[model samples]
Target: MSRILLVYTGGTIGMIKNPETGALTAFNFDELLSNIPELRLLEHKISTVSFEEPVDSSDMDISDYIKLAELIEVHFEDYDGFVVLHGSDTMSYTASAISFMFENLKKPIIFTGSQLPIGDLRTDAKENLITSIQLAGLKERGKTVIREVGLYFEYKLYRANRTTKINAEHFEAFESSNFPPIAESGVNLKINHEKLIKPNLRKKMLVHKSLNDDIMVLKLFPGLSQQTLSYLFKMPHIKGVILETFGSGNAKTDDWFVSLLESLIERGVYIVNVTQCVGGAVHMGKYATSERLKRLGVISGGDMTTEAAVAKMMYLLDKNLGPKVFKTIFETSLRGEMN
Candidate 1:
């Protein structure tokens, strides 16, 4: 039987309603099988490991991501696949970070969570949890079907780094604006084989745990003051910045603005230009406004979501590469996060 490991890192899906107060409280993973007995019907041996103190997704940080990576590394050879139960709010961030951490991953690492507590009568938790596990366990001829990190929710399986939580009140909370869904589920689970990421099974899995979070995301707006820009760029220890620009990566061409950015680049701070539009890539020189940014050595985040860009920057910064090398790799698609 296939063995699947459920790593619960805390989320709405693991909460139970209290009988007296009606407030939700963290539930025990030991009761998972009993709570959802349908799991027994699957032809897989399911096991779980949860955090000692369940962390709210808001508090999730780089250390927690490293801890998760270490957990999977320890049990890598024993399990066929792994499912991470994470909160929907920051699921994209955590999922994107973990995707970069694991290199040459040959097994499925699916992240999933629910909008409501599992104990709620109208909860969408059961379906998400069950389907996520099934997707994780899916294999073909002794080979895993999905060999990369994915986020599963509302009958859709998306590349983890491509996903963004787009809703707060709806059951379908996540969306991959730039990329297509890897798989879909209804009466049948349909795997889009062509869209799945192909891993090099010949290479051993390498986990990168060192992530530098000394980065900032600066969203550009009309008439953004030089004072504000100066303050941000002058901030000490700010190693990188994800500049969320206008459509097709357009930004102010004001001389001061361009000069400030150039000054930062000269100071060894990497700046990446990403589009604010949800569904488009950054074309740095497509317009005159962005041309100066291109000339100033700003890297283009082509069709990459902000979450993915942030995670990618963190992963790359830890490598301590030179400015030119860093720009080249940042523009390249690492872990299929960008085009």
Candidate 2:
């Protein structure tokens, strides 16, 4: 039997109600199997590890990201696949960071959770967990086709690096607008074999534990003042910027605003522009307003989600490449993250 590891962090998927306070809180994974007995039917050796102190996903940070990376690293060789039960709040961010950490990886890391507590009747946790395992362990032509980090929720399995949470109240909390889903489960588990990421078998998976956190995301809005831009550019040691621009990469055309970005680029700051829209590409210079930004040497992020843009920028900057070379690489599409 294939060994599937369940790394249960804190989320609504593992919650129970307190009898006294009548409040929903995280329940023990020891009882998780009972809640989702369908998992026993799968032909896999299941094991679990929970955090010592569970944190709401909103509280997730770089340190927790490192811990999760370390855990996956330590157990990478032994497990056929892994599932992470995480809070929906930052699941996309965590999953995206992990995708960067495990560069050129060749295994499935499926992240999932539920909007409603698993102990509740209407909870979507059971379906998400069961299908994640099935997709993770599936084989094709005597080889595992899916070989990367992914997010499984609401009957969809998406490449983790390409995902972003777009909803809060609905069961469909995650979406991969830039890329097609890896798999989907309806009447039967449907694997998009073509969409699945195949690794470069010649290379071994390299796990990166170090992620430079001195990054900021600036959202471009109408009437965004020069003073605000001035203070941001002056922030100490800010290594990278993900500029969320208007549709098709349109930004303010004012010279002073463009000049600030130009100065920052000269000062060795890596700036990448991603579309603020959920389902579009960044075509810098295609229009008049965005042409100035392109002229300012801002890297076009193409179709990359804001989460992927942030993680990819940090990963490249962590390589310690100077602004000159980093701009070239940041614009290049490594995966299908860009158009």
Candidate 3:
């Protein structure tokens, strides 16, 4: 039987109604099997580990990212695959961060969560949890099937970094617009073999624990304040910025805005230009408005989701690459985050 590790970092999936007050509370992960009796029917050997204190997804930060990476590194060889139960709110960001944290990853790291508390009537937690475990344990010819980070939600499995949480109330909260689902569930689970990532089998898994959170996002809007932009850009502590631009990475052509970005680039601040739209790529030079940004050394984020761009920047920022080197690397596809 395949061995799967269930890492519970807390989410609606782990919550149950308190008998005394009927309020939702995190269930004991130690009693996981008892709480979800259907898990007893699975043939895989499932074991769980949980945080001492459950953290709301809004409170999740880089410290939690390091902790989760360390946990996986410690038991990398003991388990065939891992299933992480995370809050749906920030699940995409966390999953994207984890994807960039590891090198030569050859085992499944399936992140799953639910919209409603597990104890609620018509809760979607049970299916999500059960299917995630099954996917984690899937193998062929003595090798794991999925060799990358994936987010499993509803009936679809998407590349973790490519995903974005598009809805707050719907059970189908996440969407991967630039890429297709690598796998899907129907009457029978199906794997899209052609879409799977193939890692070099020769390299051993390496986990990157160092991540810099000294970056910020500057989203452009109609009549965005130049005063506010100047104030934020003037901050010495800021190392990188994700510039969310208009369709196909277009932006205002005002001299002050252009000068501000140019000055920031000259001062060694890495700026990445990503499209504000969900489905398309940032073709920086395709439009005149974005041509200036391309010439100003703003890295084109291509088809990468904002969550992935943010996580990728954090991971790369810690490496301390030079501006030119960082721009080149960021534009290239690392972990299939871009085309």
Candidate 4:
């Protein structure tokens, strides 16, 4: 039987209803199994490890990323696959970070969670948990079909680095607008084998725990000014910044604004241009407004999600190379995250 590890990092999926308090609270894995006995029926032998003190998704940090990476590294040999129970608020961001952290993975690392507490009768928790594990355990030709980190939610499996939470109340909370869905669930879970990222067998899988968090996402708006642009562009030691601009990567054509970005680029700050729209690619040089940014040394993010771009920027920054050296690295496809 396949051995699957459930790394319970804390989320609504692990919460139980309390009769007296009428509140949801974190419960042990035994409690989860007792409440939802269907877990006993999966094909794989399942085991869980929970955080001593569970963390809310909003509190997630670079340290949490390192912790998640360490858990997978230690259990790599023992488990055929791994499923992470994480809060939905930051699930996409965490998933994206881990995708880059674990390079050339040979096994599945699927992150999943739900909006409602598990103990609620109307909750979305059970199905999300069940399907995630099922996806993790699947294999064919004695090889794991999914060899990268993924975010499984509702009825779809997305490339972990390519997802973004677009809704709060909807069952389908995540979407990969640029990249195609890795898999979709209906009568059966259809794995998009063509889109799945294949591992580099030659490179040994290793985790990069150190993630630089000195980054910010700035949005450009009409009537934006020089002072505001200067303030953000000149942040000290700010290794990277995500510029969310108008359609097709258009930004203000103001000379002062352009000069600010140019100066930042000269200082070696990596600027990544992505669209403000939830679903679209950044087409550099398509319009005059964006020409300044493209000419000012901003790297085109193409159709990458903000979550993916942030994680990718952090990963590239950790390599400690100058921004000029990372020109090819930022735009190049990694983990099927970019267009």
Please give, for residues 1-339, the per-residue lDDT of candidate 2 as tens digits.
568889988888879777688799878787767867888898877889888888799999889998999998899899888999899999988998888888788888899988988777777888888888787787766577578889999988998878999999999888887788888888987888787677789988898888887999999888888888899789979988899999999988888988888888888888889999989898988999999887778899988999888878767777878666787887776654565
Model 2 regions more than 4 Å off: none
Error of 2 at 230 (Å): 1.6
Model 1 lDDT tens row, 1-339: 689999999989999999899988998999888998888888999999998888899999999999999999999999999999999999999999999999989999999999999989899999999999999999889778999999999999999999889999999999999899999999999999998999877988899999999999999888899998898788889999999999999998888999999999998999999889889899988889998989899999999999999999999998979889999999999799987
TM accuracy, model 1: 0.99
Winner on TM-score (2 vs 4) = 4
Q: TM-score of each candidate?
A: 0.99, 0.96, 0.98, 0.97
Top candidate (lDDT): 1
Which residue runs does candidate 4 get wrong by more than 4 Å?
Answer: none
Q: Candidate 1, clashing residue pairs?
A: none
What shift in Å separates residue 335 of candidate 4 from its native position after superposition?
1.3
lDDT of 3 by residue, 1-339 (tens): 789999989888889988799999888888888888999999999999998888788889999999999998898899999999999999999999999999889999999999998888889999999999998999889778999999999999999999999998898989999999999988998999999999999998889999999999888999898899999999999989999999999999999999999999888889999989989999988989999998998999999998999999999998979888998999998888988
lDDT of each: 0.93, 0.85, 0.92, 0.87
Error of 4 at 190 (Å): 1.4
Per-structure clash totals for the candidates: 0, 0, 0, 0
Of 3 and 4, the candidate ranking higher by TM-score: 3
Best to worst by lDDT, what's the order?
1, 3, 4, 2
> In candidate 4, which residue pairs get closer than 3 Å at backbone N, Cα or C atoms, i.e. clash?
none
